[model samples]
Target: MVQKIGAQYLAKRFADQLMASPEPREEPEEVVRETTEVSGDLDGQIFHDEEGQPIGRAYLVRQVEVYVVSPTRAGAREELVRCLNEPDSRVYLREVDGRLSGVVYTPDPARTGERTGAMRADDV
Candidate 1:
């Protein structure tokens, strides 16, 4: 139901999904290779710890598999996910220049079960 987000992802179009590993897990060679091989969705993210060291699962965006390391979320990540489930609220992971960038919080468009204007036009 990705299209429920108002966009289609080919239903079966392959997208990479990574798992969140504990901060102590460190980066594995296989995990590193997997992230570098494909770029798409990531179930987890990689960020640097307070000590200026990398933590979490490293992932990539659209293509090229360019590595981009981000900083720690300072405990905000869990909160973001929780609030996304609230009424009319949406949380998005923003990517820029094919790297993990920041997060975007916005109000979701209310779904009325009616076709959008573009759909109506196509029906006419």
Candidate 2:
């Protein structure tokens, strides 16, 4: 039987990818939010298809929101945007048994509706 998954699990998955990267040094300042939880019903399916065969499926049991900002770097948000754009710079998901679950990428802040005005907190 398939075991159930949760938001916290997906959050950790997102966090792990950020930490294990070379460019983005692992910092404790990262944050994760439980954006949404989607069940794998008939209408709910995430997969990649090549030709007529199915390459893999992403069991999106949960949708996790992540925020990573580093004070050491200038325009850290832009850096993240570039990193996430690279195909190699991706976050892959794994099941409890350590099997390849899916690949995830940090969404662009502008597209994801996370970015607001350019004014910094200290500028306020």
Candidate 3:
């Protein structure tokens, strides 16, 4: 689904940013976890709280985890996730491999019941 792909992309981007920061002198492996935190209703609606308003439509992008082996990893992860999801983050959606990618408000793609988990670039 578009939302699933979007969340994965966002999580990856956030993970990458943390790895590239100067706080981490050594490179750290990116750990991306994509899970359906919430599913849409029959009508394809997702509800979220926006300041006091109830936003009824929008694909929710969340960070399940973004961390490094260093002590500053948790703080770095928190800052990066907050920055990416903030109003000024300027994050947008993109399409890759025929599926919608990145974080943006949009409709989800239909599920085709296929999965390719953790395929490395060399495997392609």
Candidate 4:
């Protein structure tokens, strides 16, 4: 049987692979911010799409940065965008070794988010 690895290691490895090459940065998706628009007495009126076309209901968006991470050469890519007035250092991260990779949101305000398993020599 193969040995199992931990997220700390995988996350670090993934981060390193992406950061190693800074060129050809892909475009990041914009974040959407939803707000209620009153047409008459409606407080929770339905929202529209980015094109102002009615989509039944919609909301929210952000950032001007694309921080990408992929597990395989052809694996799915996840990106994090920089919120307004947010630092570019803000990056997307995944530490779990599950079949599907999802961004692991952290409330840690500190920029320590960047230091993952492989991100630090000590983590290795």
Candidate 5:
């Protein structure tokens, strides 16, 4: 017999895996605040952080594969973008069947900028 897991269980499992992973090296504060524009399919308005600093405006680039685990590929892509826009959420990417899939977890509601209407790339 097979067992089915709820979304909450899956979420917790993903979070636990993330907690067990290595930490990423931190970048200097100035570098993180630099502003740059993203063009093409992923287009949207820009917004600032609580300190009036521009958000999502860094020039230093790194490749990231965002995955949203859903029943449909389209749903996964949509969820990925939604999670990316959340200021306080930590996104975790994992490889499944040779493709990268991601799970977003928000550990702190206080840090979440949901009320501020942070920058978003919904059109992507």
Candidate 6:
């Protein structure tokens, strides 16, 4: 029997694929700032690509939607909060309608405290 995968699992798989692929090209800092919209302060700062361009999704810390594969919503929320507080952890944010609507914790090489990249929430 094929086991159904939850949203969190799928998201993690997607993130793993992105991490395995070649790093994205970097653009000028000014251009990145103008194109990207971020609203939260991560514990370890935002990530950046090899050329110094930021990598990963953007979102407001106040409205991060956590998707934990838990049986209860409260459990999921607790997991989300825990993930957010992790030191140097990279939480990928998903934006919606110009605001942050979702977030997923994933492993990324660009989580080195440098903010770069112009990422649209819908893209995720």
| Model 1 bad stretches (over 4 Å) | 1-88, 111-124
TM-score of each prediction:
0.20, 0.23, 0.25, 0.18, 0.26, 0.23
Q: Could you tell me how far off, in angstroms, the CA of residue 119 lies in candidate 1 after the best superposition? A: 25
Residue 115's lDDT within candidate 5 is 45
Of 3 and 5, which scores higher on TM-score?
5
TM-score of 5: 0.26
Which is superior by TM-score, 3 or 4?
Answer: 3
Q: Relative to the unseen true structure, what is the Cα RMSD of model 4? A: 21.8
lDDT of 1 by residue, 2-98 (tens): 5664444533243322344445756566643333433344435676789978787865534322221212356455545544675865656667787
Model 6 RMSD in angstroms: 25.0
TM-score of 1: 0.20
Candidate 2 structure quality by residue, lDDT tens digits, 17-84: 88875675687786876543345452335455666665555554343433434333576677567657
lDDT of 3 at 29: 81
- Please report, in order, the local distance difference test score of every candidate based on alpha carbons: 0.49, 0.54, 0.51, 0.45, 0.55, 0.61
Error of 4 at 20 (Å): 59
- The stretch of ten residues in a row with the least summed lDDT in candidate 1 is 63-72
Q: Which pairs clash in model 6? A: 54-116, 54-117
Model 5, residue 20: distance off in Å is: 56
Error of 1 at 78 (Å): 16
Residue 9 Cα positional deviation in candidate 2, in Å, after optimal superposition: 61
lDDT of 2 at 54: 57
lDDT (10s digit) by residue, model 6, range 1-124? 2345677788899999988968888866764323234433554567778998989755445446556433356666665565567675566667889887886763233443454468899989
What's the TM for model 2? 0.23
The worst-scoring run of ten residues by lDDT in candidate 4 lies at 58-67
What's the ranking of the predictions by lDDT, best on top?
Answer: 6, 5, 2, 3, 1, 4
lDDT: worst 10-residue window of model 6:
31-40
